[model samples]
Target: MTGDVGRAIGFAVVGALALLAPLLEGRVDDRVAAVGTVAPFVVVAAVAYLSTSGPLFELFARPGDREEGRLYGLASFSLGIAGLAVIYVAFEFPVSAFLVAVFALTVGNLGQELTARYTPDPAVGTSAFAVLGTIGAVCAMLLAGVLGASVPALPLAVFVAASGALLGALIRSVLFVRDDSLVVLSVGLVVWFFLELGLAPTLRRVGIGIALTAALGYVAYGLGTASVTGMLTGVLLALFTVVLGGFGWFVLLVTFFGLGGLASKYRYDEKLDRGIAQENEGARGGGNVLANSAVALVAVVAFAVSGHVGVPSAVFRFAFAGAVAAALADTFSSEFGGLFDTPRLITTLRPVAPGTDGAVTWQGVVAGLVGSAIIGGLSGVFFGLNAPGVLLVVFAGVVGMTVDSLLGATLEGDYLGNQGVNLLATLSAGLVAGLAALWL
Candidate 1:
C-alpha cells in the first residue's frame, strides 16, 4: 500500500516536472537557459518513474513484486532531487534547475533497484540500491560540471568526465554492469579524474590525486550515507596509494580495483540463485586490505631515515606494478572462471564443487596467469622494468594465487573469510612480486 502511494507521488512529481519543462525551455531567457536547461531533468525524471513502473519495468522487475526495489527508487528520486538543490544553491547555475529534474529521473531509473529486484532475498537489494544511488549522484555532479554553460571549467570537466566515463564503461564491461559495484566505480573514477584536472592549480598534484581518488572510492563503497565518512576514507586511501605512489601505477590500481570491486558487488536479481550473480565473497575485498597494509608496513619500517637504505627505485615500481597485475588477474580469474571451469579444488586438480571456497580450476588459473601476464607486460612498457621484472610479476602472481588460495583454505577460512584472505594474499603477492622484480 505504501509502495503504491509512493509510486503515485513519484509519478505526480515527475509529471509536474514534465509539464514544466516546456514552459521553462521556451519561455526562459538565454542568460540562464533555466527553463530549457531544467527540461532534461524533467525528462530524466519522467523516464525514471516510468522506468520503475512503466513499459520497461515489467521486463526488468523481479517476480512476486519487490516493495524494497520500489521504495529504493523513491529514495533515489528524493536524494537526486536533494542533490540538485545542493548544486543549485552552491553554483546558482540555471542548469541547477534541470539538475533537479534529471536527478529525479535517475531516481526513477533506480539502476541499483532494477538490478537487485530479481533477488529472492532483499538483503542484497539494500546494498545494491545504496550503491546505485551514490554512483548516480556522482555521475550527476560530473555531468553538471561538463555541461555547464560556463567556459572556464569546461575543458577540465570534459577531460575528467570523459576519462571517468571511459574508465566507467571499461569497468562496466569487465565486471559487466550486472553488479552495483561498477556504478560505484564509475562514479568514483569520474569524479576523481574531473577534480584532478579541474583543481590542479588549487590542490597539490599529489593532493588532488589523493583527494579525488579518495572521493571516488568513498562514494563507490556506498559510504555516501555519511558523505564525510566516505570522502575521508577515499582521501586517506588515495593519499596512501595514489598520492604517495606514482600516477602510472596508482591510476591503474584505482582503475582495476575500483572496477573489480564494482563488478564483484551486485548481480541480476533472478540470476542470484543460479550463481549468475554469485561472486566469491572471500576474494571480494581481501587484496585491497593486503595491498594497503603492505604499503603501510613498509612505510613504518622505513620511516626512520628511509633515504639512507636507498630502496631501489625499480623495487617500488615493480611492487606497484606487480600489485596492479595481481589485482587484474584476480578480477579476470573470478569474473570469467565460472564460464569455463569444472571448479576444481585449489589443493588438488580434481573437480570438487562449484563455488567451493579456495577452489581453482584450470580455466581460472590459466586466465589469472594471463591477466598477470598482461599487467606484467604493461609494467615493462610503462616502467621499463624489463623482461625479467615482468617474469617476476608473473611468478609472483602465481605465488600470490597460491597464497590467496592457501589463505582461503586455512587461516583466512577461520574468521576473516575469503574477502579478508584474498586481500592478504594479493598484497603478499604484489610485495613478493615487487621484490623479485627488483632483485632477480
Candidate 2:
C-alpha cells in the first residue's frame, strides 16, 4: 500500500510537470525548455515498465511482449514531442496551446497504461488521479497564459475546466467496469479534445444546449424510454449537432426523438398483446439510434466542413433534411404501423402479421407521410428551402420509406438486418435529395 501511494504520487507529479513545461517555454532557453518538455514523458514510460512487478522488466521478457512494450514506449515518446510541437505552434493562442498540451499528455499516459503489463497499486484509481491531475494541469496552463505576453480568455478557461471535470467524471463512471483508471482518463481527454477543437467559439455558445440535451437523455433513460447505452449515444448525437449544426439542428433532432419515443409508447399494450412490440419494452438502444441518425449526422458534418471548399452549402442541407425525414418516416411507420390490423406485404398484396418486416398498412403509410411532412416543413423553415426544396425533401422521404419496405421484405432477416435496411433507405433519401437540389 505504501509503495502504491508512492507510485501514484510519482505519476501525478510527473504528469503535472509535463503539463507545466509548455507554460515555461517563454521563461527558459529554447533548448532547456525542449528538454524539460520531453524528459517527464520519457521518465513516465520508463517507470511504467520498470516499476511493474510483471515480466516487463525482464530483458529476456517474452519476445513478443517485449517488442510490444518497446512500441508503446516509442509511441509515448513521439506523442509527447508532437504535443510539444502543437503547443509551440499555437503558443500565440493560449487556449489552443493549453488544450493541445492536455491532449498530448492524455495520449502519452494512455499509451503507457495500455502497454504496461502490471496494474498499479490500488491506493488510488486512475480516474481520481486523472481528475485531480487535469485540474492542476489546467490551472498551470491558465497561469502560464497569464504570465506570457498574451492572456488566456477567462471564459475559455472556465469552460475548459468545467468541461474537463464533467467529462472526467462521466468517463470514469462509464468505464468502472473495466477498472483501468488510465484508460478512462485517456478516453475522456480525447473526447474533450475533439469537442474543443471542433466547436471552439461555438462551444461556449452551445454548452448550455448540450447540457440540456444530456439531461433530457438521462431522464429518458430513467423513465425506461431508452437504455443506458442509448442515452450515451443520444448525448454523442446531441454533441454532434451542436458542433456540426448548432441549436436549430439539435432542436429538430430532439423533436424527432421525443415524438418518436412518445409515439412508440402510445399503443404499447396492444402491440405487446399482439407479440409485435419493440424489444426491451420499447426502450431503444445505441444500435437503434445509430441506425436512424448516423446518416443525418454524417450529412451535418459534411456540410459544416465543406463551407470553405466552395461546395454549395444548400446541397448538404438538403441531404441532411432528407436523411432526417427518412429516419422519421421509417420510425413512425414501424411504431405506429404495428398498431394497425390491416398490414399487408409490400412485395405482394397478401395480408401479413402486424409486425411483419415488409408489412405496410394504410394507417401506417399516412402516419409515415405525416412524419415526413413534419420534417420537410421544419427543413424548409430551418434550412431556408423554398416550396420546391420542401417538396423534394418530402418526395425523397417517401421514396426512402418505400425502399425500406422493399429492402425489408427482400433482404431483411435473410441477407440484411433492420439497421442495414435503414442505412440504405436513408442513403437513398440523401442521394435523391442531393440530385433534386442539382436539377431544381
Candidate 3:
C-alpha cells in the first residue's frame, strides 16, 4: 500500500521534472525541442543500465511488477523518449499543449496505480482514478499556464483532459494482464492522437464519435456480445474509424463487425460440441477486438493524415476497404468453414478436422468470396471506388484470406498466435491494395 503511494509521488515528481525541456519549446527550434525531450530519458537509461539492480529501479517500478518480470520503468523511459519526439517534432504542438498533455497522461497513469492498490473494487478504483486524475490534470494545467508554463485555449485544455480520462481508463483496464510500460506508451500516443483530432474535425464530429461509440459499446455489453474489456476496447477502435476515417470507413467497419458477430453466433452449439467454438461463448475480449481491427486502425490513421486527396487518398481508401474485407473474409472462412465435416489443409490438401487451422472447404471459399464482395461493393458506393478498384479490393481480400490460411497451416500453432496471423493478413491485404493503387 505504501509502495503504491510512494510510486504515485515518484511519478508526479518525475513528470514535473520532465517539463524542463518543454519550457524551452519557444526559446529553441522545434528540432532542438524534440532533442531536448529525448535527452533526459537518455541520461536515465544510462544510469539504469549502470544500476539495474539498485535503488532507482525499485523506486519507480521493478522487474516482475507487470509481465514476464520486465522492468516497466526502463520500458517507460525508452518509449517515453520516442513518443515525446513524435509529439514535439512531428506534431509540433505548442509548449503549453505539450506540457499539459504529458502532465495529464503521467498523472492518469500514477493515479490508476494508487487507486487500484488501495481501493477494493477494481472497477471502482479505475473509475475513481480517472475522475480524480481529470480534475488534478485540469487544475494543474491551468495553474501551470498561468504561472508562465504557457497559455492554453480553454477548449484545448478540455480536449486534453477528456482524452486523458477516456484513453487512460481504457488502457488501465488492460494493465493487470500485461506490462505497464507499453500501456503507458499507448496512453501517451492515444492522447496525442485525440489531441490532434481537435485540429481536423469539428467538435460536433468528435462528440458524435464519442456518443455513438459509447452507445454501441453499452448495447454490445448489455446484449452480452462482448466482455467488459472488449467493449471498452472496441469503443476506442470505433472512434478511430469515425473520428479519423470518416463516416464511410466507419460504416464499412460496422458491416464487418455485424457480419462477423453473426457468423460467430452461427452454429454455436455444434461448434461447442465439437470443441471448436470461440472461447467464452463467442464473447470477445481485448485480444479478439485488437486482432481484427489493429490494421484497420492503421489504415484509417493513414487516410486521416494523408489530407484525403490524389493517389494517397485513393490508396488509403483501398487500404481501409481491403483491411475490412480481409477481416470479414477471414471471419467468414473460419466460422462458415467449420460447419463442413471434412476440410482440406491449405498447404497439404490433406483432410483435416472441421475446425483445424489451415483447413479450407469449398463452402468456406465461396462464403469468403461473398463476404469480400459485400465489402467491395460497399466500398464502391462509399469510397467512390470504380470497377477496377472494386475488383482489386475483392482480389486483395481473397489473397489476404489465403495468406491467413497459409500462415495458420504453417506457423500459427507452433510459432505464431492466431491473433498475430489475423493482424498480418489484414496488413498484407492493405499493403497489396494500397500499393497496387499506388503503382497503377
Candidate 4:
C-alpha cells in the first residue's frame, strides 16, 4: 500500500507536467487540448499501478523502476514550473512564444533525465521524456488559471490528462522502438529548418529536393549500397536558399557537398559507424565507375532542370542530382584508395601503402575527376552555361576533393564529431563550387 501511494503521487506529478507545457507554447488548442490534458495523468496512474505490481514493473522498467519513476515525476513537475516562468519572460506570442514553450519543455525534459539518471532505454526513456513534456504543459495551464482568471481552466486540465495517457503508452511505439530512425528523422527536421528559414523562400522547392536526396538514402539503406545522407542534406539546404533569393549560397552548397561526398565514400562498403574511430577506420576498395557515372547523371539532370524548368521544377531535380553526384564521387575515391596497389601521399606524389589516411591512388584520383566532370556537366546542362561555367564546377569538385583531403589530414577531425566533419566538408566543397561558378 505504501508502494502504491508513492507510485500514485509520482504519476500525478508526471501528469501535471505533460498537460501544462505544450499549452503554454500554444501548441495545444481545442482539439489537441483534450487528449493533451487527460492523457498525462492517466499514464502516470497506469505506470504507477504497474510499478507496485512486481512482475509488471519488472517487465516494463526493470529493477528500481519504481524509484526511478518517482524521481522522474518530481523532476518533471519542478522543471515544468521553471519552464513556465521562462516562457512568461521570453517574448510575445506566435513564434517567440512557440520557441519559449519548446525551450521550457526541452529544458524540463533534460532536467528530468539529469535528475533521474535513467539509463537510455528507448522504450522507457522516450516515454518518460514525453511524459516530462506533458508536465510542462499542465504547469503552464495551472499558472494561467491562477493569473489570467479569464482563461478556461477545465479544458487545459483535461487536455493534459489525455495527452499524457496517450503519450505515456504510445511513445515507445511512436519514437523509441526505432531510435536510429528517430535520429535520422530528427536530422531531417534540423536540415529542413536550415533550408527553409535560414536560407529563404525556397522552402516550396524543397519537396522534390527532399524527395531526391531521401531517395539516395533509400538506395543505400534499402538497396544495400553506400550513400551520402550528408551531401543530400547540404544540397537541399543550398538549393532551398537559392530558390528563396539567397545570395552566395550556391558556393557553400557545392563545395561542402563535394568534400562531404569524398569523405563519406572512403569506406563505401562499411556500415555507418558515426563513432570515434571512423576518421581512419574501415576497409578501402577500388573506385566504382558505376557510382561515379550515376553522380554525373544526377548532376546533369539537376542543372538542366533548374535552368530550363524554372526554379520550382528545377530546384528539386537539380539539388537531388548534385547530391547523388557528390555521394558517388566521395564513395568512389575513398573506397578505391584502399584497393590501390601503390597509394601515394596526397601531399606529395611519393608512394605510400594503402590504408594510409590522406593517401591518394591513381584509380581514386581518376575516379574523383570523372565524378566532378559528370556532376559538373549536369549543372551546365541546367544552367545553360558555356564551356567555362561547366569547366568551373568540374574544377571545383576536383579541387574541393583535395582541400577535403587536406582538411581530413589536418584540422577537420578536431572540430567536428563524425557527423560534423561531414557537414563541414560538404560546406567547403559547395563554397568552392559557387566561387568557380562566379569566376568561370
Give a tens-digit lDDT track for model 4, residues 1-440. 23433443333344345335334334446445444443454454445443454544433342344556433333333343333333332422222122223323343344335434545443234334444544554455456555432232333232322233222223223343213122222322332232223222233343333344334333333332222222223333333334432233343334434444345555444423322122323211112212232333333334434544444433333333334344445545655545557777777767865555566777887877777677667666655656765665666566556655665555555753333433344444554554344343
lDDT of 1 at 304: 23
- By lDDT, the candidates rank as 3, 2, 1, 4
Off by over 4 Å in 4: 1-69, 73-85, 93-219, 225-328, 409-424, 436-440
C-alpha displacement of 300 in model 1, angstroms? 11
Model 4, position 347: C-alpha lDDT score: 73
Q: By TM-score, how accurate is candidate 2?
A: 0.69
Per-residue accuracy of model 2 over 62-116 as CA lDDT, tens digit each: 3333556442432343345345434444443333344433532343334334333
lDDT of 3 by residue, 370-425 (tens): 99999999999989889999999999899899999999999998998999999899
Cα-based TM-score, every candidate: 0.46, 0.69, 0.71, 0.47
Which of the numbered candidates is closest to the native, going by highest lDDT?
A: 3
Clashes of each: 20, 0, 1, 69
lDDT of 2 at 319: 84
lDDT tens per residue, model 1, 1-440: 23333443343344244233223433456434443434455455455444556544543333322453442343333344434433443453343223323432334235434544466333233333333433443344455445432222433333333233323332332343223233433344335333433232213544465346645644554521212222233333444444334455555555554645544553424324546443333123323434434443243223222344677556666665665666667665665564544777666656765555676767777877887787777667766766777788777666766777666555665687655665676677767966665566
- Candidate 2: what lDDT? 0.63
